[model samples]
Every structure is written in structure tokens, then in C-alpha cells.
Target: MRVTDLTLGILTLLGGIAIYLSAMNFQAIPGQEYGAGTMPRAVAFVTGLTGLYMIVEAIMSGNRGIGFRFAEWTRSGAALARVATVLLLILGYILVSPIVGFVPTTIVVLVVAMLTLGTRLVPAVIVSVVATIVIQQSFGKLLLVPLPRSDFLSFLW
Candidate 1:
């Protein structure tokens, strides 16, 4: 865990630096001072600071009995299988969404993902459908982002 933390901290620091440098390209306007870079810069600064703190803590605290342990191939294989299942479900969503439209596709994807992750059918279907509806409404209706509409469901919206 310590090794993982250290690696993640270093990666985050590098990522933050990259974000900050990239944000520098968005030059500020004179009257309207805040540029596209402003929010990114803030995020980068915070990320960098947190990463630095983690590194310092790791160094001073002396490992804290946490370290990396590579799993056996069998365990790793199972983990990979779970990841692959999730990926396939996501890919299925992308491929099917255009045909069935966003809501139905999302519901199907979510339910499938929940089942793949070991949730039971009834709960999975209910939670998946409700979550999909909430997310669709939030991003589409409330945020004014246009979601793909099916001919069948267009009237309902």
C-alpha cells in the first residue's frame, strides 16, 4: 500500500505539472481576466500540493508497514475477467445506444454491468434504471445537453 501510495503520488505530481503547463496555453483576456486555464490551473495546484504532502508524509513516517504484494496469476486472472466484463458492457452500450437511443441503452448497460459485478436481477434492474434516468435527466434536461432520442421514446420526453 505504501509503494502504491508513493507511485500514485509521484504520478499525480507529474500529471498536475502537465495540467498546469497545458493550461498556460490559454492566455487570459484583459477585461475578462479569467481564461480557459484558470480552473485547470487551480486543480493542478491543489493536486500538486496534495501529492507533495503525501510524499513528505511517506518519507517521514517510514513505510507504515504498507507495501506492494503482487497477486498470484490465478487471482490476477479473475481480476482481469471482472475488468473485461465491465469493458464489454460499456462497449455494448456505445454500440447499441444509437439504435435504441440513450435511455434504453443506458438502462440495459447499467443493469448488465450491475449483474456482471454480482448484483441480483431485481435490485440491479431497479437501481440501474433509476440511476440511468437520473443521470440522463441531469445531464440532458437540467444541463441542457442534448441526448440521443429514439423515435419510440421521443414523445415521452
Candidate 2:
């Protein structure tokens, strides 16, 4: 389905408002002018401005038909299946990650996603492993965020 610019603009504006409100709750950084919320607030401000511009442009265009339109892809079974597969994959990742640990779960999910999207097994495996490690290191080490860990994979830690 295709949404009209006005509808999308309104949604974006609401999302920006929500983000800005949530960011307001972030604690201020000690001796720092900007806290963690600073970047989020800035991004939300830009998003809100963009949404307002879209809303204005849509209003000025004089194209007031419907808020949304059904697209041809909605009738395609293959297209729908691909979308469902992606969604199911995300659900599976969310459900399994804590139990299986981030590295293994991510690698498995990536490999399956790549294979389903027609990538060769060897390349998918290689890419999944490398990408998982990079993501783990980036978030767990560089960002100082703790990721789910497995006792069996303690060597990686």
C-alpha cells in the first residue's frame, strides 16, 4: 500500500514528537553542555521540520484523493512471502537471542537471511560470522554495551 504524503508527514511529525519527549528523560551529562538526548533531540527537530515541509507541499499540490492506495505488490504471493519471511526472521531473532547469545544468534540469522535472499552458502557463512563479530565488538566493546554471552563461547569474550 502507498500512503499519501500528508498521512506520512503526519506520522513522521508524531514520531518526531514522541522521540523528542522520550529523549527529554535522558539524564544530563556531568560538566557537559550536551547530554545523550542532544543528538536525538536534534534529529527529531529535523524530522519534525521535514514532516511539516511535506505536509505543506502536499496541501499546496491539491491532490486530495485518499490517505492510502493499494499497490500491485500486495497481490503478489512471492512478494508477500518475502515480507513475511523477514518479519518472522526478526521475531525469531528477538525470541532466541537471549537464550542462544548475540554472536551465535546473529550469525545464524544473518546466514539464513542471506541464503533465503539467494546468496551462496560459503559467502553467507563467511559474511555472517564476520558481521556478527564486528557487530558484537562494536556494541559490546567500543560502545561499552553488554551483549548476551554464551558460556561455550567464552573465548570470544
Candidate 3:
């Protein structure tokens, strides 16, 4: 189905409001000028304002109701197949990450996706590994966020 900007804007606005409200409950860090909730609240406010602007633009442009064109969206089988493949791959990653570890799961998903999209084997593997390393380093080292480690292979990291 084709969802209009108006509908998406409304949903975004609601989500932003909810996020902002929930983030307000977070406690400020001791002796810190900016609290832990500051970033989340700022992000929510920006999202909400952006959505509100979109809603206003949609209304001014005379687009009132949402347009739902299901048939028009599903006419191409190949397009649908690609979309489904990516979605299923994401679901697979989520389901298997804890078992195989986050790094391996991400690399597998990326390599498979690249190969399915007609990339060469060497390039696909290289790109996937590089991307995975970059992401792991960025989140784990730079951001101090912990990634899932496989029980069997936790020593590798």
C-alpha cells in the first residue's frame, strides 16, 4: 500500500511525542550539566517538529486522505522477491545473532545480500568483512556499546 506523507507524518509525530515523554523519566547523571536523557529528548523534539512540518505541507498541498494502492505496489514479482529476501535476512540475523555472535551474523547477512545482488565473491566477502569490522569498532570501541559475543567464540574478540 502507498502511504501518504500525511499518514506517516502523523505517526512520526505520535512516536516522537511518546519517545520524548518516556525519555523524560530518565535520571540526570551526577555532576553532569547535560543529563542522560538530553540527547533522546532533543532527538524526539527534532523528529516531532519535522513531522509536524511535513503534515502542514501535506495539508497545504490539499492532500487530505491517505492513498492506498495495494495492487499497484505488488505488480512486480522480482521487486517483491528482493524486498522479501532482505526482510527475511534481517529476521534471520535477529534470530541467529545471539547464537553465532553479532559479527559473524552481520558478515553472513551482508555477504549473502551482496552475492544475491550479483556482486563478485571476493568483493562481496571483502566488503562484508570490512563493513562488519567498521561497525564493530564504531559501536564497541568508540561508542562503548557491547556487541553480542558467541559463547563458543567469545575468545576471538
Q: How close is candidate 3 to the true structure, as a TM-score?
A: 0.52
Descending-TM-score candidate ranking: 2, 1, 3
Off by over 4 Å in 2: 2-69
Poorest 10 consecutive residues by lDDT, candidate 2: 62-71
lDDT of 3 by residue, 1-157 (tens): 7678899789889889998999987888888767979999999999999889989998999887775556664898877887898999999988998788888898899998997788999999999988988888788668878788755434435
The alpha-carbon lDDT assigned to residue 29 of candidate 3 equals: 82
Q: Which residue pairs in candidate 1 have backbone atoms (N, alpha carbon, C) closer than 3 angstroms, thus clashing? A: 1-67
lDDT (0 to 1) per candidate = 0.79, 0.86, 0.85
Give residue 93's error in model 1 in angstroms.
2.0
Each model's total of backbone clashes: 1, 0, 0
Point out where model 3 deviates above 4 Å. 3-73, 151-156
Q: Write the per-residue lDDT of candidate 2 for residues 40-107, one digit (tens) a residue.
A: 99999999998888888888897554478879998988778878888998999899988988888888
Order by lDDT, highest first:
2, 3, 1
Index of the highest-lDDT prediction: 2
RMSD of 2: 7.0
